[model samples]
Target chain A: MVSLELKRVVVTGLGAITPLGNNVSQYWQNLLQGCSGVGPITLFDASQHNCQIAAEVKGFDPSDYLERKEAKRMDRFAQFAVCASLQAIADAGLEINEFNAERIGAIIGTGIGGLKVLEDQQEVYLTRGSDRVSPFFIPMMIGNMAAGLTAIHTGARGPNSCTVTACAAGANAVGEAFRLIRHGYAEAMICGGTEATITPLCVAGFAAARALSTRNHEPTRASRPFASDRDGFVMGEGAGILVLEELEHAQRRQAHVYAEIVGYGMTCDAYHMTTPIPGGKGATRAMELALKDAGLFPNQVSYINAHGTSTLANDVAETLAVKQALGIHAEKVAISATKSMTGHLLGGSGGIEAIATAMAVATDRIPPTINLEDPDPACDLDYVPQLCRRQQVDVALSNSFGFGGHNVTLAFKKLKG
Target chain B: MNKQEVLEKVKTIVAEQLGVAPERVTPEANFANDLGADSLDTVELVMAMEEAFKVEIPDDEAEKIVMVQQAVDYISQVAN
Candidate 1:
């Protein structure tokens, strides 16, 4: 008598539209080259503002991805989401027309959805009166449209939902997708996050709260994660999507398996709305939990994709959490903060970073964390600084923490076949 | 714009705004029923039509102007 094991889940596809690059390959190349996508804000006039730069998605023409009329109906955030999802679907070599539509699902997360649309409509309301607003306001401005539109576009009739956990939303969405496929709830899931909140109102709000970097004079050097001279995180806008499939299903289809998603851990700080816990207790526990769930020791993980938002408090707290979780092995892990190059993508950060981790394990190349000239005493980890390094990373982990103290950690391992 | 011109303009605006065929934006077609417009879309459509026709549509009148014909008549009265 043979007992069946629970089906494993692996990353079959990856897609991203980021400030660093519009596609995953370009993004990965930019990360290896240590290119800083952070620059002067060009989407709107930031001359009169204190926070004048952002990691804006440069030269994105939605017409390349969406239909003429469909483009008009969706906000930029949703457009990014759908476009990234399209790329992922194509990358996986999965044909929606050929598959059972009822078994496919979509789970997209967004931190601040459709802010551009909302703000624009608000201006029309104030100047031209409320009656002058567009008819697509609600659909274009809502956070859930990213997931909803993906389902509509792909004919996915299975479970469809979204997470709104700020920066952690992307990780949560992917982690939840893993469960959906592992537990026999679904055969495949298209999960990730999208965010295009780099509008004037979003910048102004973050600036008012003193949460964004004020180094407008040096936009490229502004996002210095884990550096002692770090001021604040730079805002960014983009989306990423990953196709997660059951292991057997992927093997049967002869799909390219990037990495196996082994475990996920989530926690809440319950301490502050905008600040992490003093000693990084929540993040530490999250890492520990994820390691335990994967049944692996800290020494097994050779790479880490740190959240490292370039904020003073977050960088220190994240480093502290790594030390607490990995102990003596913390120094051996090759850590890199992709946010150092892409800026803080908010909810979309975790999804894209997860892809980076999987790619690291798949390609045996660890990307670098740029702009770490003056390392902070508080962050003493071996952050693969300034230059990309080639390493045989068998296992990797990625962490994302959000406002309201939400924390998420994901673990990935190279396929052992 | 005359009544006929106003109707034609309203139909074109509604067709473009709602993403439907211009011929489908008839006087009797309901915004939600035939045009596939959700509630938020109706508001935006009114705004676009008002901008295109150079007229201000009152909320009270806007609420009653769901059909293309109703929008044309309302714009005709206000624009002139």
Candidate 2:
């Protein structure tokens, strides 16, 4: 067998602390049940703001997971990444002494890393003095701290980097991790995304840009992806991570395999910074190239975890992209936007959604796109609305489109015997 | 430390820290259940109490001091 065939990448573990739930089991359960995590903004006062709803991780306690000093040193985003990575590492059943340090890597992504730190430090500078700003400001604010801290804790000496392509970051990190194993760059990699940008500044910025929903009266129902009345995305926070291992390495170690990473495609919209191209041209190419990378035809794709952000534009553009890439098979494919339930976690969306896709492949269950009532005619597809469906999902595609026209798609498949 | 004085100070601090009304800070109120303090808030509150009174609170000790009275007594004993 060729090295590509011999050294396939597989997902050995999954972890997430999402708006919908605090862990993988809870998140997956809520996802299948179509439960909405969106609600009135609790992190800050939204009384004076246009957008008053967001999806916040309900019971997060960073100090519970990290030391007090460490927790103080890191901002919310880094804390989320560390927490999710801890779960992933434990789930993988990896022994610290089992593998060479150089053969293991860590890659975590953040769309807007440490926005909370930015806000806090700016406040300190304004209210107090520049000298009063915490000495850990820069370290806490940098996007790479998540991966760097993970590496420091676990002694993962291989390639470590943070992807910051806005929303596509999660998919980009996972895809890059898969390639690390494929190219023999690393035997195993811990990869995913974390984001905690549901702050006053972030919400105000999105609202100022007219990118967030103002459905304050009905917070739970505010995030209605693919619906005709959809207005804009609901800001969310949390982290999701996966343990990727080389097929041979996992087999030799008798590790559990959840699913296989079969394909990854990334492209640029080249159209706009904040808006996707007029018909999802970049998104279509991303999915097409992803299918090609998976060596699967359109018919082989059973489900799609759409990046349906509950915004008017993303839903239409993503629906058309699927149609363009998958042809007639797009109609047959069951499309579900887990974001409809979990809201958009920015960079963390792709990691958890990838886990959702792999779980759908592993468990033969497809999560539903909640709040799909009154769907727009433009986004007409089998959105797996209302309830979970038990269907044999051999392969699933997860799409993530970010700002700056970055588009990414990843393919996962059931592990073959 | 006068118990009433300690209780009043504790109530004020808990109310301010947890974002609740001072009258809501009763001896029977649970930090998480009645006072609306999440795990993080509780931890920070304990730290603040320690700094205010110049005392150390172990995690086990902090967990035991859930109510306003308990926290005030614990602080008074350690501080005195």
Candidate 3:
């Protein structure tokens, strides 16, 4: 094996257009307060669908962030990506001039890219003839358009790409960006995920698959991760982006470092497409690899951001994985599933949850998993349910598992002088 | 349609498509240089004008109609 010396990477900025809030501060506050963001499906007419509620990002006007003409041409997903990225770039206080433009990069991921746009355009073509379809349909519907548009908006001419690994896409994007900077590919990267898939077709598809919660009467209490009565995940839509820079580069600029990314672990189960391995063997291995990559023991970890989708299968599997990966220390770690509040952001979940994890490490406060009442016996770990906790977290791990058996774990630690 | 009527409609289309004030869209305003329209915006504007006027504008002809006055003149001629 070739020995590789990696550079330290730190998160300097965070931006989010989440179901919880439109910005990072608002999202963090709502997560800590145990507020649920799920509500009635108002984006479109969901009367015919079995699942009628979702965690939709409300009051997001693309014109507020982009030119009206520009906003009209891009899909909602791309709009969210550009808006969040611009916020992150501004938060970092790093100017991208001609000198440093080539050193900056962007990697934004999405699970289902522009599903609303595609569905709408297809309907237009079928009903109004092919010529009636808008010229911007292709650009609006492609998944990579988010990354492409973000580069156009920010003038980052360096490496640009998109990761499309279903739910794991966001974490994979951040992890890949960390590798890019760690291995000396780029000095700084604007990386995360964006998804606006709360459309008619998406809701219908998930509902048909029985993958969504049908608790329309009580939307706020629909997402109950780690609870015995949990049924399924509630679909959510939003974007989360972070500006990651090399430690030395951030130090030189006196950037406010939120947390240091010490490790990234990615693996594939190759067992099933939609369902995770029976006992989360792949997930357990990913966490172990992340711990090893950080050169830290499992006992060193203080908190965990779980991939708890409020689904019975996912919660039990994730619980088993944590126990197997951390051994006895799993019970000691304070784990929280912000998805309980934000709902399942799908591709965008990992990105926002990673930001939450970093903030927990930096602020020494862990957000709670809302609606986790009467926790299942299988999920016996400290889930930090119903209330936030104040603890000095030395290291925190965020986990993301996608539909295609893709498992990713990202490790963040409090910056030590 | 008369020249004045065509000019009024063209101005309205330009103002609506570009998200600009109606008063700002003068006959002399250029779609790109003055109205802040990129290449894609120009195409969309042409498409909108075609739909509004019920006229088929060829690509070469569309390229020639840059100014608001030029669009008004072209539409007036074709409409008559």
lDDT of 2 at A345: 92
- The 10-residue segment of model 3 chain A with minimum total lDDT is A1-10
Candidate DockQ values, in order, are 0.48, 0.04, 0.55
True contacts kept of each: 0.73, 0.00, 0.45
| lDDT by residue (tens digit), candidate 2, B18-69 | 6677889998788988977767677768866765676789878988887777
For model 1, residues A203-291, the per-residue Cα lDDT tens digits are 99988878889998999999999998989999988988999988888999899999999989999999999999989999999899889
Extract clashing residue pairs from model 2: none
Range of the 10 consecutive residues with the lowest summed lDDT in candidate 2 chain A: A1-10
* lDDT (0 to 1) per candidate: 0.88, 0.87, 0.92
Per-residue alpha-carbon lDDT of model 1 for B1-80, expressed as tens digits?
79888888878888887778898988899998888887777877877786788787877888987777788778888788
Chain B TM-score per candidate, please.
Answer: 0.92, 0.90, 0.95
Question: Which candidate wins on TM-score?
Answer: 3
lDDT, candidate 3, at A96: 91
Residue A378 error, candidate 3, Å: 1.9
TM-score of each: 0.91, 0.83, 0.96
> Candidate 1, chain A: TM-score?
0.97
